[model samples]
Target: MLAEERLAVILETVQQKRSVKVSELCNLLNASVSTVRRDISTLAEMGKLTKVHGGAIALSENFAAVEKDMEEKAHLFLKEKQAVAQYAASLLEDGDFVFLDAGTTTENMIGFLPKKDICFVTNGLFHAKKLAQRGFRVYIPGGEIKCSTEAIVGAECACTVARYHFTKSFLGTNGVSVSAGFSTHDVNEAQIKSAAIENSIQAFLLTDHSKFDQITSVTFAQLSQAQIITDRLPDAKYRSFTTVKEVL
Candidate 1:
C-alpha cells in the first residue's frame, strides 16, 4: 500500500476503535511498526488524531474545537440522525408547543413529525423555511445570525426563548456527558440552548454516540435537565446522567 493509503487506514481504524495499538495496526495494515509509528506521528502532527503511548486515538475534542458549518454538519451521521428524529417525533403529540434547537439532528425532526397540530419555535434559521413549508407553525425570533451554525443567538434570542414555555423541546449538543452535560463550542449559542431547556416542560437532547465522553467549550445545561435520545451508548457509564432513549 502507498503511504497515503496506510495513513488513511490508520486513521479509519483509530476512529472505528476509538483507540488502536501499534500491534493491531501492524496486523491490520500489514505494515511494520516503524512505518505505522511514522504514520501516527504524521497524523498527530497534522492535528488529525492524538498520539498515545503505543498507538493513536481519534481526538473528538479536537474535532469539536474547530466547529463546522451547517452544510458540512448536515451530511454527517445521516442515518443516525434519521433514527433519532423519528424517535423524537414519536414523543410529540397533537397541539404541543416545541423548541427545535439549531442542529442537523433536530432539523431532521420536521420530516419525521406526525401530521398533527404542532407549533415550532426555533432559533435555527435554516430550519424555519423547511418547517413552514411542511405546514407547521414556525416562529424564529429576530437576532444576529450566527454564520457557522445559522443559528439566531445572543441575549435577544435567549429572551425570546424565555418568553414562551414549550410543551416539549428537542435540542442538539456538541457533547453530552454525565459531568459536563450538554455542551457546545459557542457561548452565545449556549445561552439560547440553556434558555430553551429552562423554559420547556420536557427537554430532550438529540446526539449521536460520538458525542459521549467528549466536552466542548461551553456547557449549556446539566445532564439531568434533558432526557437523551441517541442512536446508541458506548457503554452504560452514562446511566447516572439521564434517561437514555437508544434508537438502536
Candidate 2:
C-alpha cells in the first residue's frame, strides 16, 4: 500500500481500538516493520496518535467532566466490570481489612465476595449497605455524599481513610495514563482514593480497557503506586510501570 493509505489505515485502527501494535498494523497494511514504524512516526509527528513502545494509542479525547449517575455507569462495560470485579473479590482472604472504592466495578465485587472474615471500609453508602447485608462487617467513613456518583467524598472522608491502614484496597479510576497515572474527575473523590491507597499494604485498580490512555482532571496516584486488574490491557507499555492482571 502507498504510505498515505498505510497511515490512514493505521490511524483508523488506533482510533477504533484505542491502541494498536505495530506488528498488527504491518499485517493490516501489508507492509514491512520498518515501513509501519516510519508511518507511525509520521502520524505521531502530525499529532494524530501517540507512539508508545511497540504500538500507538489514539489521541486522548476529553471525556465528560461531570460524573455519571451510578445507574448509568452500571450498564456500561457490564461484562468486563463483572470479570474484573470477580477477580478482585477472589483476591480477598479471611482477616483481611479491605478498602473498597466507590464505583460500579467495586460495587459488583460485593456480590462475588467470599464468605470470609473480611472487614470492609468504604465511603460508598450503597457499598456499605450491600456488604453489611451480605453478612460482612463493613464500615463507612463520615463524609458528604456526592449525589451524582453516590460516593462519600470530602475532607472528613479522606481524614478517616488516612487513619486506617488496610490490608488491601480495590480502587476505581476515570482514566489510566502512563504520564498522568490514575485519575478521576472529582478532587474530593481523588483525595479519598489517594488516602485509601496510601494507607494500604497493596492497592489494586479495577478498570476496563476503555480507561487506558485516557486522562482526567485529578490524579490520585502514580502508575507505580497500584497494580491493575482489568478485563483487557490496551497497551503493553503499562506493564513497565506496574503489574497489570488482564482477566480476559
Candidate 3:
C-alpha cells in the first residue's frame, strides 16, 4: 500500500480502538513492522496520536478533549480501586473534616465511609451525591462539571475549596511519577487538587499501580505533601522520592 493509504488506515484503527499496538497494526495493515513504526512515528510527530511503549494511543484519550466514557473508567482496576478505597477509609476518624478529589478510585471510598455526622467536601458530583444520600454533611463545590470525568472544576470551585479547611484529604491523579509528582490531564482539575492539598492538614493520594510510571499534563502536588496508598509498592525508581504504603 502507498504511505498515504497506510497512514489513513492506521489513523482509522487508532480512532476505533482508542489505542493500537505496533504488532496489531502490523498484522492489520499486512505491512512490515518497520513501515508501521514509521507511520506511527510520523503520525505522532504530526500530533495525531501519542506513542506509548509497545503502542500508540489517540492523543484525545488523555482528558476532556476526548470522550472518556464513564462506564469504561468504572470497569478499570475495579478490585484494586476498591481495596485502595477501603484502606483509605480506615484512616478516617470520626468527625474529621475530609476532602475527596474526583476519580474512580477515590470515589470508591464513599461506599466505605461511616454513616455519622462528619463534614465531607468533594469536587466530584457522584461523591457528593452519595455522601448526601447517606445523611452525611456533604458539600459540592460550585463550578462547571466536566462530563467526561464528572469532575467539577474552574475558578469557582477553587475559590470554594479555599474557604474550607479539612483535617485530611484523599486525592487521585492520572499520573504519579517520582519526578513529576502528582499530575492530571486537566489544568483546572489540577488546580482544584492543589487547593485541596493546601487546605488540608494531612493529605493522602489514592491511586492504582498503573498510574505510577505515567506523565500527565499538570502537576498538582509534590510527593512530600501526601502519602500514597496503593495495592503494591512502587519500584526502586520511586522509592527515593516518596513514601508508598502498600494496602493488602
Candidate 4:
C-alpha cells in the first residue's frame, strides 16, 4: 500500500482499538517494522496519537475535553479493567467503608461489589448514584462536579472525605511512575484523591495497562503509599517501589 494509505489505515485501527501495538500494526498492514514505527512517530508528532513503548494510543482517549463522551473508552480494554475491578472489590469486607475513584476501571468495581450492607463514599457522582440505586449506603461528597469525568472535587469534597475514615480506598489515576508517583489532570480531583488515601487504612491504586507511564498535571500520592493493582506488571522502571499485583 502507499504510505498515505498505510497511515490512514493505522489511524483508523488506532481509533477503533483505542490502542495499537507496533507489531500488531505491522502485521495488519503487511508492512515492515521500520515503516510502522515511522508512521507512528509521524502521527504522534501531528498530535493524532500518543506513542508508547510498544504501541500507540489515540490522543482523544487521554484528552479531558472529550472525557464526557465515555463511549469512546467504555469498550476499550474491557476485560482487563473488569479483572482489575474484581480484584479491587474482593479486598472489601462486609462492613468495611470504601471509597471508589472516578474512572472507567474503578466503575467496573461497582458491578462486582455486594449489594447489601456496605458504606461507600465517592467523589464520583455516577458511582454514588449507582450504589444508592442498588440500595447500598452511598455518600456523595459535596463539591463542584466536573461533568466530563462525573467527579465532584474541591475543598468541600476533600473536607467531607476526611471526616469519614475508610477501611479501604480504591483509586484510579492518569499515570503511575516511580518518580512522579500517581498523577491526575485536575488539581481538585488530585486533592480529593490524596485525602481519600490519607483517610483510609489501606489504599489500592487501580489502573489498566494504558496508565503506565503517561504523566498528568498533579501528583496525588506516591507508589509507596498504596499497593498497585493493575492488568500487568509495569515497566522495569517501576518494579522496585511499586508492589504490583496483576489481575488475571
Candidate 5:
C-alpha cells in the first residue's frame, strides 16, 4: 500500500480504538515496522495523533473524571485484581515498613499477606481495618474520609504520610498514561498518593491492563518513579518507563 494509504489507515484505527500498536499497524498495513513507525511519526508531527512508546494513541483519548466506589469496583476485574494483589503481597517481608494505598486492587492484597514483623501505614479506611483484622500492625492517618472510595484524603493525610519513611509503597491509580504517568481524579487524593511515594524507598503501582493509555484529572507520580505490577501489559512501550511485572 502507498504511504498515504498507510497513514490514513493508521489514523482511522487510532480513532476507532483510541490506541494502536505499531505491530498491529504493521500487520494491518502489511508494512515493515520501520514503515509503520515512520507513518506514526508523520501523523504525530502533523498533530493528527500522539505517538506513544510502542503505539499511536488518539489525541483526544478519554480521561476518567470520577472514581468508582468500592462496591462497584469489587467485581469489575475480580480475577485480575486477585492475581496482581497476590504478587504484590508476596513482596512483603519481615520488618518491612509498608504503605498501602486505597483501592479495590490494593485491598485485595490483604488476604495474601503473610504473618510477619511488618508495620503498615495506610490512608484507606477499609485497608487499615482489613490489615488490623489480619493481625498485622497497621496505622491509619487522620483525614477526611472520602466516602466514594473510602479513602482518607486532605492535608492531614498527606502530612501524615510525609512523616513516615516507608520501605515499600503499593499504590493504586485511576489511570496510567505515557505522558501523564499515574493519575487520579481527585486532587486531594493525588496529593496523598504523591506524598506516600515521595516518602517511600520504593514504590509500586498496582493496576490492571485497562489503565494503560488512559489519563485522569491529576497526576500523582511519574512513571519512572515507581515499578508497576499489573495483571497484563497491553503495550511494550510502558516497560521503557519503569519496571513492569505481569502477574498473569
Candidate 6:
C-alpha cells in the first residue's frame, strides 16, 4: 500500500484499540518495524497520538490535555447557558417526550425545568440522575462511556435512541456555521446526537454564544435540521441556514 494508506491504517488501529505497540502495528499493517515507528513518530508530532516508551496511545483518550473538562466548562458562559436552558426547559410541558443532549449547556437546562411531567431520553450520564431527581422519568442508552464528555456513545447509544420517538429534542454543539451545520469534538457522541435529531418531531440545538463560527472534528447534522438556541447570534450569515432563538 501507499505511504498515506499505511499511515491511515496505523492511526485507525491505534484509535480503535486506544493503544498499540510498534510490533503489533508492524504485523497488522504488514510493514517493517522501522516504517511503523516512523509513522508513529510523525503522528505523535502532529498531535494525533502520544508516543510512549514502547507504543502509542490515541490523543483523544487524553482529552483533558487538549480540551477543558466538565467542571471547567460549567463556569464558562454560566448566565448565558442558564438563560438559554431556562427557555428550553420552559418548552417542556406535561407528557412531553424529549431528549436532553449531553453537554454543559444542556446540563444547565435541568435546573431551570418547571414542575411538569416529562419523559427524557438522554445520552448524558450525569443528566439522567438530575432529570430523575426533578421527577422527570429518565432513560439512558446502553453504550460505551466517554469519560471526557460524560456521555454514553457508540452504536449501542444510537440504537437505543433510535427505538424511541421524541416530541422535542434539545441538543448541544461545539460549532455552528451555515456551511458546516452542527459539529462536535467526538464522532461517536456526534452519532448519538444526530440520531436524536432524526427521531424527534422538533429539534432544538442549544449552545453558548461562543460556539458560533467554530468547527470541531465532526459534523453531526445539517443546519436546516434543527432550530438554534443560543445567547447571541454573532453572525448574520447563519440566518440563511437555520432559525435562531437568540435568548438575549
Could you estimate the TM-score for every candidate? 0.75, 0.77, 0.72, 0.71, 0.77, 0.73
For candidate 4, lDDT tens digit of each residue in 1-248? 99999989999998887667899998999999999999999998988888766677776444221122345666888999999999888777788889888877888998988655789898887788888877888888889988778788899999999898999999988877554578887889899999999999999998888887555666799888988998986475566885788977
Pick the winner on TM-score between candidates 1 and 2. 2
For model 2, name the residue pairs that clash.
none
> Pairing residues by index, what is the TM-score of model 1?
0.75
lDDT string for model 6 (71-154, tens) is 888899999999999999888888889988988999999998888888899889899998888888899889999888898999
Model 3 over residues 135-172: C-alpha lDDT tens digits?
A: 88888889989988899999999989988999999999
List the global CA lDDT of all models: 0.87, 0.90, 0.83, 0.82, 0.90, 0.84
Off by over 4 Å in 5: 1-57
Stretches > 4 Å off in candidate 3: 1-67
Q: What shift in Å separates residue 65 of candidate 4 from its native position after superposition?
A: 11
Q: What does candidate 2's lDDT look like per residue over 153-199, in tens digits?
A: 99999999999999999999998987568989999999999999999
Candidate 1 wrongly placed segments (more than 4 Å): 1-63
Each candidate's root-mean-square deviation in Å? 10.1, 9.3, 9.7, 10.8, 8.8, 8.4
Model 4 CA deviation exceeding 4 Å by range: 1-69
In model 6, which residue pairs have backbone atoms overlapping below 3 Å?
none
- Top candidate by TM-score: 5
Distance from true location, Cα of 234 in model 2, Å: 0.6
lDDT for model 3, on a 0 to 1 scale?
0.83
Better of 3 and 6 by lDDT: 6
Alpha-carbon lDDT of model 5: 0.90
Tell me the TM-score of model 2: 0.77
